[model samples]
Target: MPLSRQLVLSLFSIFLALFIGAVWISVSNTKNFIEQQLSSHAQDTATSLGMSITSYIGDKDMPLIETMVNAIFDRGYYSAIVLKDADGKVILERRNPVSLEQVPSWFINMFPLSPPVRVTELNDGWTIAGQLSVQSDPGIGYGQLWDNASDSFQLILLMFLVGLVLVWFLVRMITIPIMALVKQSEAISQQKFDRVELKPKTLELRIIVDAINLMSERLSDLFGRLTNQAERYRDFAYSDELTKVGNRRAFDLAFEQILSDAEHQTSSFLMFVRLSSLNQVNCNIGFLEGDAYIKTVSDLLSEHLNKQDIDFTLYRLNGGDFALIIEGIDEVTCLDLCQQLIDKCNAIEKSEYESGTAQIAAGSFNYGDRKKAILEQVDSALTQANFNPLKWQAVDKLQTVQSNDTWREKIKALLDKDTADFIAQPIKSFSGDEIYQEWFARFPEPDSKQHIPMAELIPATIRLDFSQKLDELLVRCAFTKLSSQSGTVGLNISRLSLLKPSFQHWFVTQLTQLGAQCSHLVLEIPERCLFSDTNNFLSFIVNVQNLGVKITIERFGAQIASVTHLRAIKPDYLKLDGRFTKNIHTEKDNQLFVHSLVDIAHGLNIKVIAVQVETAQEAQTLKDMQVDFVQGFFVGAPIALEC
Candidate 1:
């Protein structure tokens, strides 16, 4: 039972016991008083009536004696009155049976009242008259007793009702704060630090409330510190100190991740830009000016690329040197982006550099490209740009790929016909137990049986502006497939599509239509998403989660602000970036990093998933770090969706 009810019942039981005792005492006293009064009344009446009838008895005036006796009998106080002769023969008698109209039969039977009879010797002028007897009727006494007890019972009931109300109030006063404390404790257990605001007056309850509030405050403070600590950890390891962009180590980690994701096959470019005036500026001006210029360049890159709605990461490899890996765009678009960067930088550096702005070199690569090969191509182009009049060049373009015109038409036709196939890849626990599956979209080449790799297809779709339609198609197809599936399925939604208000509305409507089936679907987005358009992304997440759909953050360790953002986002799953999960068994830094990430995620009540688990050793290592799930070729390979 609820505590309030239990308290009320307990107090009411005590009151009930007291009430019963009171009624018993009242009834018992009334019964005794009524009996005593009856006996006393009978004695008084007998003595007086005998004295009055003595003269009549001596004269033998039977009519007069009868008249006097009848007068007393008519008073109705006595049940019977009799006059007997000296020989013990009855001369006169008056009798009446007891009548108790007001009292119930059960009450009367439970408390039997007997009429009291009294007799006195009568005398007639010194002669003994027959004894006169008078018996008192208890009916009047019983009626008085019943009325008193009934009034007492009613008065007790009123008090009892008033006491019950007091008890209810008392219970509420005690339980309300206790219940609030309990709710606060539950929220704390779920990693939500909400304080109990109500202060109770009861000493014990108030103490408890103060204790809980103190704990919550301390925990909230601790979480804030922990989030900051995580940010520090990420920045120290991956971020450039001066420019606040990815450091050389971060770029390598990201590049390694793309290289490791052999199944998805990503196609993108590696661009290198070297400042033409940084050396001169640092020699003529101070290092502070050079640092300021580098910072400006970093900011400009972020500002310009974020507007493109393309996935890219800019990095500060070293002083006067920067690198960027831009994805989800065609070669022509990437070249155009390069030209814009060159022009924009020159416009800012007319006074600093006679040779104009920085030299830009772009080299394209696909998944599985060697780190050395991509770097050498881009670095050689960078060296060549120093001599070229334009100070910009594109090297090793994807020669085998179709032109942008061909891709636009192909992607448009495929989206128009809904001609993409989907496959499912299982994410399983370390024990090889299946947890859930993720769906991937596969598109075939337009006029060939061979399908274009995802590396090429993703960029083409984005460049052609077909990402929104593709996202819609994939989500709808997954929702349809979920109807017959027993477990949930996941789909990756592009950031470009998610930013569109129209796509957001359509996605919400589609999720609502799923109803119960929404539980069977999960949406995954890159962790880098938080670094841009975060408000819109958060709003989208709220809508999706409100509809009972799950959200997973993929490429989770990509952003330094992930810990702080995760606190706000509260995704259902946090899939670690492939960079951290690769060779986890052999990398001590990776182990420590993954362990902390897992701890932080688990602390927030969010499960951690280690992605790109390509070996049993890595899976076991991740399990040791307490990753909740693992997914990759070793755990399960992608298979055609049955439906």
Candidate 2:
């Protein structure tokens, strides 16, 4: 049933059929010709004998007649010859014993030959003196027929086999191209679009091959384009625009994956970094220059961090901040990594100062309970670095009792009520047109007058290891508020919220519940948070993108080495850190830096937003730089807005 076997069998069958028919025809025709030749010889002999006898009779010579009859009988062509007197008595007869037995009885029966018997009357003058009879010996004819058929049959059998073999070989050659095409087609069906280069010169086969090649070429092109698009989308979802590091969303995702794996398979550690003096540098030299410094630092960190043996990831959490998640590692390994990062940061600071870039400060913390302890350690280290200007220190501060107790009380109260509050900030376009509102966290209080920024409250919850509960509440509150709104609304998530595995399921469920009403929701994350863990971050961003929600990287260009990160994780928008737009007109260097940043972001199809604009001149400068959106005191302060 295979193609090759079927082809061979069909061809051989035809060959055998034709061979048998040809052999039979050849044997039958040969036998008939031999029989005819023997009969003709017998007739000629009989005619000659009669003529001789007639002459003798006319001469009236009895002796001559007898002699002639004897001569005719002596001739061996006839099996029998008889001379009879007037009374019909036989005078002469001849037969050969060896000739009679030469032909087999079975052969004669199978192909019987009947040659006509001839007789001539010999008369003396006008009277008939005697009659001559002659019969041809069928033995010689039968013998020749049998011998020739046997020889011819053997030759025919040999030729038939040879011809069949030749035909089989020819068919195989003919089907080769077709078989190759079939294989290629099957491979294509499996999405393996590999091509065959062989060309069959036969007109029909050539056409088929060319068509297959054309189809393969088209499919390869289609798959290539699709792959490129998917990669671009992936980059946009996970990357920070300015610094190019994994954003907070990416980092949180990676962190959760690592933690889960570690809980099930291996040990892992989280290193949270809070860049000291980054805010000061942005506030002083401007955010554009600040971003350049951050990009440079990120490059340096990545160069040292990308060791083949180490399982580590780096992310840009927010302005002048980053995080690293090292999986299958211990506290000692975590400490060593932190030291290396610190050294890299110091080297970057020195290099920047020499190049007239802004000075930088850095702090790091290693966490076992990454979701809670990582941020707490980083925040504590940052506070220490800020308070003590002379030396960089890793402050090993535990969460305060008051912070822990407050988070407990707050979570219990929220759970009991099952209610939360939301705050909305307007993200205006460059022309002062309202593009959308970004939602931030708000806590419900018995007294309407009491209000606090979600930033402070969320960090407090993270330090208390209650961010998962807080995130669920925030998502519910944010969704409810946005469902009633007419424009886009952005929501912020903490690193702690993202590292929880259940967050993805919970977030997706919330979106499903909101249905079309959630279309306007945009999730905002700090750029620094993405590098906290690479794998989880990449996975998280990809998962979120599948949900059809818009995502943005906040406080973009906060890291010193942002370019490398941007190449890997392309975020949707680069929200220019506010420090850059604070005093744009007076700074020539800042304008150049902003222009360059804008160009880079645009090249990657990422939008740029300038935050904290205060003057028309500043807005005009940003507009010239082609900033997509602007937000600041000059545009409109963060005021209490209706949900």
Best by lDDT: 1
TM-score of each: 0.85, 0.51
**Lowest-scoring 10 consecutive residues by lDDT in candidate 1?**
559-568
Q: Which stretches of candidate 2 lie over 4 Å from their true place?
A: 50-91, 97-133, 137-173, 242-245, 258-265, 274-292, 344-370, 382-643
- What lDDT would candidate 2 get against the real structure? 0.65
Which digits, one per residue and each the tens of the lDDT, describe model 2 over residues 1-643?
7677787888778877887788778768987897778777777887787777776543357678667756765665557777676668776566644364766677677788776677877776788877777777777777778888788888988998898778777777668888889898876654457777888768888888999989988976765555444344435655788766677766765564433321122344455555555666677778887777788877777788765235456788888677766543333344555556666666556433432222222222222345565656655655565454433344454223244566567667765666666555577886568877766565665335465334245444544556688778778767766756788887877655665667867777777677776558777776766666767776776667666677787756444224445545566777865434556787664566566667656755678888767789998989988999887666665655564
Which residue ranges in model 1 land beyond 4 Å of their true spot? 54-59, 62-66, 73-143, 194-197, 217-225, 383-391, 396-420, 443-453, 456-466, 496-519, 529-549, 562-564
- Tens digits of per-residue lDDT for model 1, 468-583: 88788777766766788898888888887877889999999998888988877788887777776778878988999999888898887776445557767889998888988888
What TM value does model 2 have? Answer: 0.51
Per-candidate Cα lDDT values, in order, are 0.83, 0.65
